[model samples]
Structure formats: C-alpha cells, structure tokens
Target: MLGRVLGGISTSLFFATFECWMVAEHRRCGFGEELLRYMFGLMFSVQYLAAIGAGLVAQAAASVVPLTRLSASSSWHYGGYTAPFDISLACLLLAIPAIQMSWTENYGNNKAGAAGTGIAASLRAGARAMGSSWQVPILGLAVATFEGSMYCFVFNWTPALDAGGGLPPPHGLIFSSFMMACMCGSSFFGMLDSSYRPVKVLLPVILTAAAALGLTALSLARGSTSNGAVFAGFLIFEACVGAYFPCVGTVKSEVVPEEARAGVYNVYRVPLNAFVIFLLLTDISPATQFGACCCLLSVAAGAVWLLGRVEQTR
Candidate 1:
C-alpha cells in the first residue's frame, strides 16, 4: 500500500515538475518563443533516448541479480530484482546535485496573484482560467482525447503483439522500438516546427493519428490476424505520441498563464484521467476500444481545427 502510494506521488511529480520548470526557466532567461519550440522538441527527443538508456541500464542491473522467470520483460522481475530500484534511488540522489548545479528556484504567483494563496484557491483559479480562455479548453480536449488514446495503446500493445501465436513477442524489444519511433517523432516535430507553427503542425498530426487509429481499429474489427499490418499501425500512432508532447507543451506555454500554469495544467489531467478510466474499464473488445480511441482522436482533431480557425481570426 505504501509503495503504491509513494509510486503514485512519484508518477504525478514526474509528470508535473520538470515541464513546469522548463517553461518557467525558459521565460526567466528571456528566450524567444521560437527557441522555446526547439527546446521542447529537443528535450523530448533526448528524454526518449534517456528512457531507452535507462531500460538498458535496468536490464543490465537485473542480469547481475537474475529473477526466477526472466526472459525479455526484465522490468517486471521480482524476488529480489531490487537492483533497478536501488539504481533508481541512486539516480534520484544524483539529481539533487544536478538540480542544485543547473537550476535556480523560482516562484509562481504570489498571494495577491490570480492563482491566489492555498491549494483550493489555486485550483479554483485554474478552473476559471480554463473556462475563460477558448484556447485552454480546446487544448484540454486535445490532451484528454490524444493522451487518453496513448494510454489505451499502452494497455493494448502487449495483447496486440502476442496475438500472432509465435514466440511470445519480444516485449522488451518491442518497447524499445516504440521508444525509438517516438524519438524520431520528436526530432521530426523539430524539423517541421522550424518551417511551420506548432498549431499548424498539430492539425495534420492529429488527423494522421486519427487515420492510423481508424485503420488499426478497422483491422481488428475485421478479425484480421495480420500482425505486421496491425503492428505498423500501432507504430504510426506511437510516432504521433512523440510529436504530441512538444507541440502541446509549446502551445500550453503560450495559453496558460504562468501564475496559474501548474494549476490549469493539472486540470487537463483530470479529464485525461477520466478518459483513460472510461476507456479501459469497459468490457469491450480491443477492436471496440480502439474504435472508441479513433472516435476520440477525431474529436480532438476537430477541436484543434477549431483552435486553428480561432488563432487565424486572432
């Protein structure tokens, strides 16, 4: 129970802290918004590489202390597969010094700011901020549907890969490949952003994502067991996942006020969380679930389309 609680806190912090810091730090240093897009794309690309590296490191650590049922999925190793946890602790401790050396502490809104004082007030301020701005809610809708679809993919991929009745698909290798695709995606975003605005970049990405998901869902619905085709579709969506983070981050930095950034940003997660639960909780088949995902992404694409229209009018 305690470990789960601690893990949940860790997950929340991981999602929230570094991105907030990046935005705040960027503004503090007086960097151009042009540069901000580059930084976000670069950050995600490197972050994806680091995640791959961390997986390699964890696997190496697990080898030194092998588990009873070890194959490809070394991540789930138990019975004193504790080496990764130790490494995690050491890395976290190392980050303390890294933060001290590289980061300067900054504050958000003061007591008199729009975010006000106290958690309750901050949350209320976030709600108001989200409602007040068309951009914020549209962005929130994108996060809910797009991010929710990403989570659905995560849940579905294992059963997806294993369906072909072969040597139980190399789970670890597949995960690493997915990460590499995401890395490519972030780099792709950087290149595209150099020529086009993030808003412009997002519309096609969302539409392509919807198309890819629609294909995947249609394949499953038709009972096609062609693993290669389905896997390709899955990879396409994963690539879209990579592009999504930086694009959303760049736009979010523009729309959400810094004083209420964290609060309003966290608000996006509320619908996102509910979206995931609703999708995953149903008793539907993978085809149905993925069809639902495709529908959701279509909605997100519409929202982004409207956002683009509004941006043009502005």
Candidate 2:
C-alpha cells in the first residue's frame, strides 16, 4: 500500500511537475511557439524510444530469473527482486545527478504564500481558472473525454490481442510495437505542427481515433476473431495517442495560465481516473466499454471543433 501511494505520488510529479518546469523554462528563454511545439514532438518521440529500450532491458532482466507465478499470472518474475524495479531504481539514481547538475529547479508562483499551498488549494485555483475562460474548460473537456477513452485502450489492448486461441502474445514485443507506432505519430506531429495549429490538427486525430476504436469494437461485438483487423485498429489508435500528447500540451500551454498550469493539468486527470476506476468496479464487456470510448471520442471531436471555432475568433 505504501509502495502504491509512493508510486501514485511519483506519477503526479512526473506528469505534472516535469512538464510545468519545462514550459516555465521554455517561456523564460523566450522561444517561439513553433519551437515549443517542436520540442514537445522531439521530447515525446525520444521518450517513447526510451520506453522501448527500458522494456527491452526489463525483459532481459526478468527472463534471467526463475519463473514462479506462471500458472497464476502470465508475468512470471515481474515485481520480484530480479524485476525491472531494480533497473528503475538504478535509472532514477542516474537521473538524480544529471538533473541536479544540469537542470534548474522551477516552481509555480503560488500567490497563496511563499511556502506554497497544498493540493486542495491548487486544485481550487485550477478549477477557478477553468471557469475564467471558454477555452480552458473546452480544453479540459477535450482532455477528459479523449484520455478517458485512452485509459480504456491501455488496459484492453493485451486482452484484445490474446482472445484468439493461440500462444500467449509476446507482451514485450507488442508493447515495443505500440511505442514505435506512437513515435511515428510524434514525428507526424512535428511535421504537421510546423504547418498547422495544434487545435486544427486535433480534429482529425480524435476522429481517426474514434473510427479505429469503433471498427475494433464492432468486430469484438460481432464475435469475430480477426486479430489482424484489431491490431491494425489498435496501432492506428496508438498513433493518435502519440499525436495527442504534444498537441494537447501545446493547446493547454496556450490557453491555461502558467500560474495554474500544473494544478489545472493535474485536475484534468480527475475524470480520467474516475472513469477508469468506475470501469474497474464494473463487469462490463470489453466490446461495450470500448464502444463507449468511441462515443466519448465523438463527443471530444465536437468539443475540439467548437474549440477550433473559439480559437479562430480569438
């Protein structure tokens, strides 16, 4: 339980704090928005590549250990002493020096006090900031709806592949493939963002994602065993996932004030977590759940379109 709590805290720090720091630094340096978009693309592309490499290293470490939980879990040595957590620790240790030596510590200008406000205070401010503009809440709507669908993809992808009677899917290999597809999407973002605004780009991205998931859900609902079609659809969805991170970041960076950036950014995860937790508590069919995601994406597309209109007027 303590480990999970720590992990949750770490996840928040990773997604919120690191991004807040980078964007603050970028603005401090006075770079162009074009450059910021480029950095987002390059950063995520490299991060995906690192994920692939880390997965490979972890698999190598895991396979070295004796299999103990084979009957109960497809993952044998995971979370064991010989698992990737050791490598994760080592990597974190290595990162400490690089960060301490090279990176400057950045903080949000919390007007509440120099000592800073607590989580609840930050969230309250974030919520208030959301109310201040049409774009903020609309951006939040886009994030919540799209990411609500995305978390479903994260949990369902492996089972969707494994349902066909066959050898268990190579989990690591499949993950690496997904990351590569995301890298492709990231590269695509770099190319497109150079020409089009991120808001404009998100319209087709959300639509393509919706279509991909819709097709896959249709197949699953029909009791079809065509894994090829499902895999193709999933890859398409992941590419959209790659495009979304930088695009969403760029959009939010434009709309959300820096003072409330991390707070509001973290607040966007509220609905996503709630959606995922509700799904976890329910016994809904995967096809039904995934189809629900398609519907939500349609809603997100509408939101994005309206946001585009709003952006045009502004």
For model 1, the stretches where C-alpha displacement exceeds 4 angstroms are 1-4, 58-66, 69-90, 108-116, 193-195
What local lDDT score does residue 48 receive in model 2, on the 0 to 100 scale?
91
- Per-residue alpha-carbon lDDT of candidate 2 for residues 1-314, written as tens digits (9 for 90 to 100): 99888987887788787778878889888888789988989899999999888777776776677545656656644443367777889999998899899987665454446356678877987998989999998888889899989988888887888886578776666788888889999889987737798999999999999999999999888888768888899999999999998898888888999888878988988887787778757878778888989998999999999999998898
In model 2, which regions exceed 4 Å deviation? 69-82, 108-114
TM-score: which candidate is best? 2
Alpha-carbon local distance difference test for all models:
0.80, 0.84
lDDT of 1 at 160: 67
